[model samples]
Target: MTESLNSALGTISSVVWGPFVLIPLLLGTGLYLTIRLGGLQFRTLGRAMRHAFFDGDEEGNAGDISNYQALTTALAATVGTGNIVGVATAISVGGPGALFWIWVTGLLGMASKYTEAYLGVRYRVVDDKGNQLGGPQIYLKRGIPGGFGAALAFLFALFASIAAFGIGNLTQGNSVAAGMKDTFGVDPWITGVIMFVFTGATLLGGIQAIGKITSAFVPLMIVIYVVGGLVVLFLLADRLPAAIALIFTDAFTGTAAQGGFVGATIMLAVRFGVARGIFSNESGMGSAAIAAAAAKTSHPVRQGLVSMTQTFIDTLIVVSITGLTIVASGVWDQGADTAATMTSAAFTTALPGQWGGTIVSVSLIFFAFSTIIGWAYYGERSLVSLVGQWSSLPYRLLFTVVVFLSAITEIETAWLFSDIANGLMALPNLIGLLIMSGLVARETRAYLKFDPKLKKPKLSVEEFTAAQMPNWK
Candidate 1:
């Protein structure tokens, strides 16, 4: 029965994430949003980065966390196994060209990321507890107006709740456990217990705690991993140009089988690239919008721009470093078993002694732990949207328990479950974004026209909310 269920899920996931369905829809929606927004992501990325990393939240803004904290919280959720393991998987299966497609997905995904954040803030509402709650649940239901909108919102929350466990929790926990076991011989149960304690402790404080913790460590973890990757790239400096050429050339012409790598077709490159790209950054998945909605900002457009930078950092920088290092180190052709360990393997080969594996193991553990806390919020919020505030604590407890279980167990099926749930989560969000794109474009253009710097919006949060979303209160 278990095998049959797993097989069933595999079939469903394949179809859900097929080239004709989600791949094109995700790409098409992002393309449409990019066109509608007038290439806003490209134009304002500098300003967006400023807001995300340097700027403080403007006074009188309505939300729980600062822009930087929110960005990091969102970053905490995104920059996990995907950056390391997922990128390696893409290159190994799809070849060097897959990295090129991942870039395409990230580039286009930036627009979709901006749109979801914009709407998340625009349609956000305060709960009875005075908590700032929002996401696709709030936006899809309220932004679209009526039964259809409510249904879409429900589906998003449903899938997100499931994905929070699979993609956000189980997959991360399993990765961390597996990495530790391989590198340090730590028992999976021990890792699971430690994660459970830390996860439960952090989650007790909710988003505020999550925001603070993620902000402190997310940047540090990223820098450590990136620096290690660069060292590997530097050691393989002579092969840099050729590795880059393979990324572009193979993207057009399928990679021929070499070493232990089975040759990949151009279509295979596009498929894994797009799939893992979305998995890594989660630009259109609507999960990040939940964090965006909690950001302290005067206008939706301001936070939206800040939020999109998460994708830029996740895929364009972190994933790029991992992919390039693997390709440059010449270890990506070592067959399917190497996907999870490819990045570390590359680093191990380049860096002397045990430094390479240790760096990756530590980063993977922290990245996975951060993801657990981050997704705990997403899942709890999702439940709150469905069953109201009463479910939040129980859901968090349940989520924590599951984290331990996932760590101690073999969970290959969890990846399949996560892929399907993540894809399904994106569907309603992409559709809603397409439907409400006009609003996203109009508001964005208007906001950018007035305060391109986001230092001060023409109207404060109150005035802006009242003017644009009069019925929100």
Candidate 2:
């Protein structure tokens, strides 16, 4: 039965993520939105980052966390193994050219991320307990004209919450523990116990605590990892041109067999690049929207602009660093899993021996831990949206247990299942974004036209109503 289930899930994942379905769907939607919103993401990215951090609007906002906190929390979840292991995997399987496609995905995804966060804030609702609830689910049910849309959104949330436990919880734990075991000889059980305690402590404190922790850790981890990657890149300065050339050339004509590389086709490069890019940035996946919903922002567009930065940071900057380093090191052609191990190997090759490995191992541990905390909040929010706040304690408990299990389990199947769930979760979100595209565009236009000195339009109730449609309660 397990085998059959795995096989079924694989088929579903392939079908859902196939180019014919996902490629055009994702890129097409982003293109349409970019035009409709008058390239809001591109024009306002800098403005968005400024508002997210420096705007005093957070002081009087009605949400649970600040825009910066929310962005960091979302970034904590996104800039994880995907930036490292996922990028390596894409380049290993898809060739250097995969990096180009990854760039494309992240660039287009910025617009999609903007749309998700805009609707997340605009359509958010307050539960009976007065706790805020929102995301694509809220908008789909409320924003669309029919009950069917709401149902689809609810289903997306359900699967996404379950997926958080696997992808966000166990898989991360597995990767971290495994890396520690391999690099430091730390016992997996020991690592798992430590992680359980750490996660339990943070998760018990809820979103505010999670946000605080992620906000502190996310920046630290990014700096450490990026610095380490830069050191290696600088060392391989001579190979930089060739590495970049391979990414573009191999993306089209296929990688020729050289060194340990088995060569790769353009299709493989595009496939892996797009897949890993989506996994890394998660622009339309709805998970980031969950975090964005909690941001204290009177203007949805402001938060949306902040949200776009997550993609830029995750895929465009960080993942690109990892990919280029691997290509420059020429380790990707080795028959490796394209994971942290591969990235470590690449770094080791580029740098002075074990120093590279040590940096990657330590960085992965921090990145993975932050991801666990962020995803725990995401899952908790989804559960609260589905089963209410009373179940939050039990949900946290279950989530902790899953995190422990992830440490000891071989997570390939779990990873595959999580991928399917992610794809499934995206479907409803994309539907909602498409249906409400005009509303997002209107919000952008109105916000741009309004003089900041005047009374901000009365949007709270409308936003709440849009979020709490017939599908929610």
The model with the greatest lDDT is: 1
Give Cα-based local distance difference scores for all models.
0.89, 0.80
- Scored by lDDT, model 1 comes in at 0.89
Cα lDDT of model 2 by residue, 1-473, tens digit: 77887788778877777778776787778788888888876777776666665664465667888889999999999987778777876777677898999998898889899999888887788866676788876767777877887697788779778878766887789888878988899999999999899989888888889889988878989999999999999999999999999788888888776655677887777777777788889887888888898888766767788898899889878998899999898887875354548889888987775899899988888888888888887777777778778878898888887778888976566666767777778777877788889878876777666623223444652354245332422
| Cα-based RMSD of candidate 2 | 3.6
Evaluate model 1: give its TM-score. 0.96
* lDDT (Cα, tens digit) per residue for candidate 1, span 12-68: 977987888999999999999999999988999998898777776665568899888
Q: Alpha carbon lDDT of residue 379, candidate 1?
A: 89
lDDT score for residue 254 of model 2: 83
As a whole number from 0 to 100, the lDDT of residue 221 in candidate 1 is 96
Per-residue error for 132 in candidate 1, Å, reads 0.9
